[model samples]
Target: MLIGAGYFFELLCTGQLKPVAGQPIFQETRFGWVVSGPADNVINSGGWAASAVNLSITENTETDLEQSITTFWKLEEYESKSVYTKEEKECESHFDNNINRDESGRFRVRLPFKKNDYKRDTQLKQDYIKCMSEYEALEHMERVDNEIENKDREGKYYIPHHAVRNDSSTTTKLRVVFDALIAEDRRDFQHVLWRPEPTQPIHVYRLNTLTYGTVPASYLATACLENLANTECDSCPEVGELIIRDFYMDDYLGGAMSKAGAIQLRDDLISIMSKAGLELRKWLSNDPELIVNVHSDNNNIRGRGQCPDSQAKILSEIATIFDPLGLFGPVIIIAKIIMQKLWQIKVNWDDVLPDNICAEWQRYRDGLPSLNNLRIPRKIISNKIVVITEIHGFVDASEKAYGACLYLRTTGVHKNIDVKLICAKSNVAPLKIVSLPRLELCAALLLSRLRNKLIPKLNLKINRRRFWTDSKVVLAWITSPSGRWKTFVAHRVCEIQELAACSEWSHVPTHDNAADV
Candidate 1:
């Protein structure tokens, strides 16, 4: 059976269609009510239906006569039979619900929608937005990248206008040179280069400007590139590669795995830079033969020697080389504690230290000379396949501090399981009083995060992971449901589980925990 356009549209929009005396266009569906005729397309249109009766109002001020009509529709959820209502009062209420007198007066409307529909439509709009965002993703084209780009890579490489004084002999005559870009103060200070001095009345000589002082960063980089460009390195590519990243400003600092490579790089550097009028004179090396070749004038010019006695005095003055591996974290932590103690007493910039502080500082300083004795192996060759490799993390907290440390253990690679301190981190406890258990939990979570990060870079295939903590309370908390704990414990437990789900949690005697150190 076919329905008229008006009836069909009403069926689509309102979930109701009454054919002239005999036909029905509405049908039952799993989703309340929907249109039955024409095609397979259907909607849960019952959710969109207005109130019971349809209200039509028409106003004609020209005659002062207004007419309104009310009509009924069947509902599938509650109505099995058609119901009819013709109440003028229902029209008045619907009109009042939607009306707020405006310049465009509501003259006439065959109540298109009942009052309640507008409220639900507005509320559901946000949910529809979410639904479209999720379900419509595959149907639509991916969003275009509209962000404006700056040529940052090009900008990073730009040299400063002027750098490095050509005449400065603490340095040498550069094989390459650059023009000096004058400073703001010297903008009007330019006298023509190759010209006579200002004091001299004679301008007849070819004008020349005198240049002096430190060179800018830009000129230095360009000069370095130019020098390398001129130097021949086709036969010694390894030395050339070392020189590329090794130079810091004008000084070279680099390392090699083999003494032979070190000797070769040193000799090549001396020969190559000499072409640019630069001398590689002060060479120091661990290998005796390499040192003998350069024959450094200073007797103490030995690599990996003890710290100078004077360098041992000032904590801040001596270079604290950035140790990413945390080999000397315990030693560094001592210095950090001393610094914090100094701050606690409100020590001024130039304050003389208390005798106890100075004595302790001196003792720590004396121990630093011995730290040079520690060395990381260049390589650990193992033929046997790794049977098991495990990372063990230990966490601890005190009134003053909290920390976490990791160790890597490997078996089958060695007769006795080889173990090494992988990395460690520590934090001073906050001034606010906190329960020891909470701090212990914080340390565990920190170690879990460290495990997540270091796992990707580890060369050995890890078979197991473990976390150690002395705090029984924290252990109880982790083994228990998250809801059993308070806010502090619950949040940290959730994070720890997320990051270290594969890790086993275990108790460790406080004396045995390396993190306690």
Candidate 2:
């Protein structure tokens, strides 16, 4: 019997019915036709009728073979849902046990196999679709919707499942799920699954972009492109803001303005300043003279360099001195501070900071006391002026490896230690733009270079040239007792110790340290 609504069984063979003397017998298709032995045949032929035991496959031959297979076996027909549920358990068990059985309870019957078996392929595809549909329904049971929560912590928040899936970080998770599906599908063989392409951000062009207040769009564009590969989207906008701000503040306005270039980059800087919203008032300008301290050559500790700690101290002192009105002091005494302590890690400017770059610095000043007293001696201040040597690269051909510079100053004034670029004899070795620790060693080596070439060159020098940079970590590392800097910095430290026999160096904060500009 056909078990359920969408199914039918093909009758390949049939049983026969016996005829009686007075009654005509007919075969029935509903219940399988049954045959009985006749009494006369039972006596003559050992109780078996010839026609009763013999059965034949009924066929309309060529035409009926295809029609019968299609109609009764449902090679291409819609299966009712109820019939699917009825057959599901049996089919599932057969698949699970790697056994195949016909719906009529027949076993071990082999059908002719063909390469393009469309009926079996279609059934297999439908089975997977059913499984996936059921799987999604189960997974969605706990949460039908996603939610996101914004916490007050810095750089941190919670994202719901929907948000998580949308983020780039979740690409791996998607890949894992896809891999699992592929693995399940091709369980008998090893196979690789293809993944979707990753999405990338669009870069938009901005006009009126300022480079040192001069609108050097070309230079700014080049710098932006140089660091483009390192750029990631996490804080892309914030980094962009810094690029814009630094171009204006550092290249045009900072003490290192002349180092930027010709074309008088910011020829009308004052007008540019007007656009930036800084009004130059007469009373604001008249209050105090700007003092700039240049610590060009000491390697032991930062003596005159405006280290962050010292710079903070100086700003506080001025705030104390000028902060009477509470409002005016914050505006007046505090110098514009730009710190680049980590700039070395990000940029190795050995290419831009050329070899044999002309430099002049103030020699070490004597009669200076340690910073513990918080007083800068007058003699040291008055006598401070040293001729700076040309800074060169670590190699003759490569220009990227260049020496470090440190500068400090008060608000609103340019100090007499103003620098100008000029061609000079190539005397110093090129500096190496290695790691931070190595860079510190390079700075120390540069100081030692000054002592070797300058101390005897200056009759044992007045006292000692002060070295300054923004790396407090480097400073502490080099100055620590029994400091174990890497061999490069250690070697440089030894040179510094010998140079200390003549002069001293100091570490400074990046804010008050202007050389980074």
Candidate 3:
């Protein structure tokens, strides 16, 4: 029986179990290998007896018996080893004290949730809190409506009678609700107006000029719009878009006012407020904690019916409502994209260093008078001043190449105090540096540098120090009245004008200027 059982086990292992109902075994080696009934064989006690076993060639000949043995053994006695994670353990520990609690010594199932577990419930609880807040605000609004209705019932329509209205309690409550909502959104009213860029970190709030102040209210609204969905006030559009829309609507209603006009009005209002010694705009722009003027237009006939200034102020306030951190990610990202696109366009090298002056420089350096014999020596010129320009075509595009500028000055109109302007390029190009044109600029920078660096060393006390450039355009720009040169080259012209503020700037019409050497 053991032999037969072993034989049967071998057949199962090799997967060769096949039998004809009444057939005898064909044994080649005369070893006992016979099929038996369940009644006779102890191994077949679990109903392996007399069963029709079928066998067919199912797989390829190169199957691994060792791997099959390992798989069968693993299936028979192996138990899956489960690893409990830290979260699972923590959950189990939490469940031990809360979920699986013993009540009256009986395993009482906890129904669902406790009062303190409102946060655990995702839907109903959050909705309930939001609804409650809205209801409170609505109730406050309704109370204001009720007070107005009572006033109407009393027939108080006259100016004096209407003047004695009292809705402070309701108004205060409404403000509280709005403030709470603002807080929830991580937007603080005061913060929006004062936040700076995260990377540059320049404090915009501190830069207050007579013309403009630290972050405008519209800027704050821009921040809110940028962080709309992520903020507590997700439902509301940014204050700027709404304000602009409202402004357009007002324009539709026979009111023709532009942002520029509003700005002008603000200035006028500031002037008016200053007369009363209550310069609110300046203070508001400068001091973060300064209380804005709420009652400035209360009695003034000029501040009649719809106070535009007050509306603007209010809108500005709303716009600056910022999240605690200042500007959001999306706004910065959009701003960066804009900046990148701007960077893509080729740089204006001519603007950096113009070619006309550069051509003149080449002429000046080639034994010309402009570089050496100007009304003032190059050495005494301010190092900040431009002396000569170098114009060279770029390898990629000749029309839009570099225009290297050089500034030179003498220390005190002395020969030793000479300064030179060198190429602004990374590597020094000798030919470009010492070339006829470049030398003139180099001479200018050298002179300017020398004047600045060596004048103190020389201890020269000249009452009227001057520097000269032969460009008539530059000279005109420097000497022209601010009102006359307002177009075409205002920025550049202003720069030249500023240079003339300290030193005597006069035209040296190409012939006498030594830089033209």
Candidate 4:
């Protein structure tokens, strides 16, 4: 017998039953006919029973395929927050108020602690003692005994420290790092180190310079650099500007076009940093003669053996290629497409890929070694004197991907023209089917952004800037009023116009557009 409830049972029962003697009955229901009753042949065994089984299976095929594509292309959307937080503003204010220069010309800054009542934990105190003991031994710290603690002032704060050991380090294997994040406020910039032995007196040492690993350490250091630049801007403006722009934390990555210019920049850097008790070291350059006097060492580390054939391994190989400027965008786009396919198929991290994908990955992996044979010139512009300088950016798009390429076009005093590719960027198309014109517009927007970024960082003077595209539709949309079109095209056109003027955009034949490659 079949059992159900509500409308289902009513519908099943609201049918005529056609019965025949010595045969099963057939009932006509809303969902057509249903067979009922028993088998024709019965076993002659006693206490026998029959049963039936039914399964209603359902499957969901919906997937956000665009998410996988966006992830593979690293096209992340970031919400812009307030530029400065309350803590950051407080840190900046503290630096501005307490910062000073000693008679020796070295800048001095106080630690910006958030709270005054914080006390060091027992384990932290022990670590601080050990770190201070080593500091005293190295003569980097001195013991103080004359000054007594003033009850009117805030309580003393202790910064905890720990050692970080590097087995591959050649000079210092163990480095003691102070935890500035956990530091508290205090009137006196002193740390007390108690010796385990009762006979030895407690030692108090004042920290003079900016403490590393502190919450305000980076801000203080950066502020000091900026102050130094401002102080020396009247005399060495270029060096000052370089200090503000080129210095990433403590490392400087600036360069000059000519040898004499480089030597001057190096000297100015040394002089400016010396005024603030900072020294530039480990100087390295492509021109060996520039740093010939600096000692250098070579250490070769072997790479791990070939990775196993798996989805995870393919991703690992893809990440190993470091093309910061997207110079290899064309080649890398292929790998990105493969990754998108893997994501679409919902392959587990370590699961084996489909045969077709695996074969494609292996071919791409094997061809990567051939990339070493390709060499690109470091300098985009020629050494000869150039009378005219221009930046040309080309944008193109296909069904699979869209990209933009920027080239430096220079004309020498002799009217000799030279064009070299400076930078290029590409992104995989969204999985959602989009019109080709829309992708071309995206390529144009990418080109405009690329130009805006490249032009500012370039030290060379650009006489003119031009943007090229193979799509006439994109050109018309850019030249016309942005409000005339739909939201998608209009928004991109507005941004493109803001970055580059409508006149700067022009149409190029697909055959001539370098980005088409």
Candidate 5:
């Protein structure tokens, strides 16, 4: 009976069945009653057995996903290791042998496939037929003559393909994916699609261009772009450099100092990319006039949406701001402080914010509209030649945050002095309690880093750079030797010293420090 019970007695292992004190318990099953309780040691006294199992599952959070994506793309941006496999070498050789320019100067490339024969899947053939019918209707593929014999298919290989449909895709809602591993049998059969008709024989078709989802599609496309840039470098060096440095995949991101410079750069980019059969569209710029001629429909520009009423919505709104230079650091810091507070209290993203924070956020959101009235010169100074240029940086720290701002001071040929704010950056104070003097030092270090980064990028010939802070303790730390301070202070002071000389840093009255805002 026990043998036939099978898993009926498994509950005893689960510990859910409790024995009555000195009483036997019976459970009814298809095999009959089973008794279990505290019993005299009959077999246990002679032997002992033990078993254990452990399991763990970890999920990728949003932060982890973002970090992984950053790391993956960073590898692509840098040169690969100084090593190559046989397959890699072959791929490079094939690209060089088949890549060429057409009569219109557009680049043409071929697929890279290993020399191997692969078996075909029946389901793949059915999918290919269904997809090719749509492709022929759209005029994306043409049918070949049926007179071609099987002997003529020597260099041709059939590719297994299937259609993928995504309702959320803004562009092509449906696209066909070709499997590279199964499609590697023939070099000439890049994509062998077929369509059957009741009254006629099955027709064969092939995709002309490089198909997405292929193993070497991304490599081939990137190589083609690099080749275009290299070939055109002699005639358009600047544009070629921009294409190499500024392009992330198909998008081009760059800037110029003046309207004329921007226009010239735009024309050069269009001319060069057009040579490779690439036309840039949907151009966007901070200056409306720059894109007015290209995008005549002003409605295409995104307009402000309804005000955010929840924490999640507010965060989404904040992410939409496009201030890369941190020119609005002072105004933006308020929002950052609110966000930090929300995180501190461990507020749910979609939950209603606390009354105090919600009120503060609402006030900040309401005042944002007034920013339209604020204006600053795009260029630091007029086109007139300047004899002297200097960068002045200010830093300050409060109990809640620290910030740094830079100003460009120029002396024209007429001895006229012009001062303008160049850029600014700010950060919320760490949640860990810290001394005000330490915060002040952090601010000073922030200013040092900002100056060091801006100087290399600025086109002007800066004669001197100076930093200002309101904290006397910070000035003392900068003047004294870094070895005298603790690890935190010592590290920041050392970096600050390395970035700027002790003499370049000075003290300013609290009221006079612009960063105090």
Candidate 6:
């Protein structure tokens, strides 16, 4: 017996919600009533005779049924905490094993052969509200106070939304391209909860304001702009694609190969996103001419582009380097390793680090400033022509962590072999640690993942793809057929074999493996 708090909140905004039997409901309602067998779902804001439910729905004049362009959530009247309804407060919170009961011992179901004609229309409207409420519930769970702000891992000049863009995408279609869900910081399915401010009472939202720095917010915002780009400006297909693909969350972490192409893309991206009511800001370009044309000097942008002051300082990380591509893999791994050691000792967020941990963390932070000098040229050889190219991957593991890296070795016009590190990944050994060989197998798997991603990301043609690993056992595991190893090694090896062939793997001395470093 539950009605969405969001729908009710919407009506409250337009002054349409009224107390019905002491239950808040709009004069015109979506879910007419889905109360219990002999009882109603809602009673009052006070203690209910049975279960209590309320919905905030707005009565709009033009009536397209109704929906919110801004917010995706509204909580149960004031369910700050979850306690069983008095009816079944003692034992367990479930109607029966057959029914889908939530932790709060509340649920609703469609009754078969319930109605036709007038009743059918009511049923359809209920379905709409139920579907919308469920979807909004999912979206709300995604954007609560929990947040993950990615530091400016790649030291680029102009980054949008700066530190917050690191939260990975949550869109259904594009979730696989970036990272995936790890362990969440808070409890799961935080349905129908929105607290705009901590000091004020917990009120439902009218605008879709998830956590400001959370992944769902950044992903949904960009996805909104991208969808708008497609539907609004179908004539400009290139602009639409760039809007969707080139962005990492809100930041445009992409570029074109030539000046004409870059300028055209830049202009189209800005114009398209702007049309969707999304403003592009902190526009940084290697081309000095391009930068001047796009950069805005005016400080006040009404929350459109750059937030007045963060115009120039977009190229550095605040705490951690989120180099998804392992350019700084080794150094970043070391920092994480130190953090792990500290965590092992059970230090809280505010606790001061021990001297050893503090020193290492400080060194890493200090070294980050030097990344400003380490420049990777934007032009993939604006001067030379490459006759041949090779993609090499290196993998290694220690007790603390395992890592992998990808390097492009190109034989250019002079037959010179120039090697450049593209991207890498470093994962800390699992808590219930496996053997070194298993960890090495994990590193190899990471290398394979990096290879699959790096190949598509790079705009180059390669003659060969190769992988190197320091561990002989991991190499044997890869070289052997899929089912030869035990469960742990077998699973990783299976993935590696699928992504990278046995012929592609080679054994290198521990010191020589770049990933080992």
Writing each residue's lDDT as its tens digit, candidate 1 over 324-406 gives 45567676666656655655766544567677776776676677667666665533323355677888889998877777888
Model 4 C-alpha lDDT per residue in residues 1-517, reported as the tens digit of each score: 4556666666665665557764556666665666665545553477464332232334445334433434455743323235988778887888888888988888877777663221445554555566678899999978765445555446766677555657698976556777854443443644546677889987767555566755567877889999889886678787888899988889888778787888888888888898888888878776677777655443222244454567777776665655657888889999888877877998767787788888887777777767766677757778999999999999999999999999999999999999998888888899999999999999888888777776778888999988999999999999999999999999999998988899998899999999988
Ranked by lDDT, top first: 4, 5, 6, 1, 2, 3
The best candidate by lDDT is 4
TM-score of each: 0.42, 0.20, 0.19, 0.64, 0.62, 0.52
lDDT of 5: 0.74
- How far is 209's C-alpha from truth in model 5 (Å)? 5.7
Task: Report, for every candidate in turn, its global Cα lDDT versus the true structure.
Answer: 0.57, 0.33, 0.32, 0.77, 0.74, 0.58
For model 5, residues 1-517, the per-residue Cα lDDT tens digits are 2244556455333223335655445554443445655454444555753222222234545664334323322211112236878888999999989899999888788777664222354554565566778889999977776736556666676676656767598876556877755653234566565667677777767667777777788888778878888897687687787777677767777877799888888888888888888888878776787886674333221435555556676666565554646787777788777767867877665787777877787778787777776676667765777888888999999899988889989888998888889888787888999999999998888778777776666657789888999999999999999999999999999988988999998999999998888
- For model 1, the run of ten residues with the poorest summed lDDT: 66-75
5 versus 6: better lDDT goes to: 5
Ranking by TM-score: 4, 5, 6, 1, 2, 3
lDDT at residue 477 of model 1 (Cα atoms): 82
lDDT of 6 at 32: 40
Please state every model's RMSD to the true fold in angstroms: 33.6, 36.1, 35.5, 19.8, 15.3, 22.1
Worst 10 residues of 2 by lDDT: 358-367
**Per-residue lDDT over 1-517 for candidate 6, one digit per residue giving the tens place of the 0 to 100 score:** 4547766655333334444455434443344432222245645677656543444344435322112201111111211236655533321222122223235322221111212333556644554455546657888424433323655446534221101122355632111122343311222322345677888687543422234444333433544555565565678876677667677777777777788888887777777666545567777665567767665433221212221122011111222244544566666666556545655777544455566655555565566656655665655433467888889989888888887778878887887777877777776786786788888887888778767755876757778998998888888889998787778888888888888779999989877877766
Name the runs in model 1 displaced over 4 angstroms: 1-315, 318-321, 376-385, 413-416, 481-483
Model 6 TM: 0.52
Tell me how many clashing residue pairs each candidate has: 12, 32, 50, 1, 0, 11
Put down candidate 2 lDDT per residue, 394-506, tens digits, no spaces: 10111222233222211212234433211111111223345554554555455455334433422222322455545665566556542486666666666667655322446
**Candidate 2 lDDT for residue 132:** 51
**Candidate 1 has what TM-score?**
0.42
Q: How many backbone clashes can be found in candidate 5?
A: 0
In candidate 5, stretches whose alpha carbon ends up further than 4 angstroms from where it belongs are 1-60, 63-102, 108-230, 233-236, 241-249, 255-258, 296-310
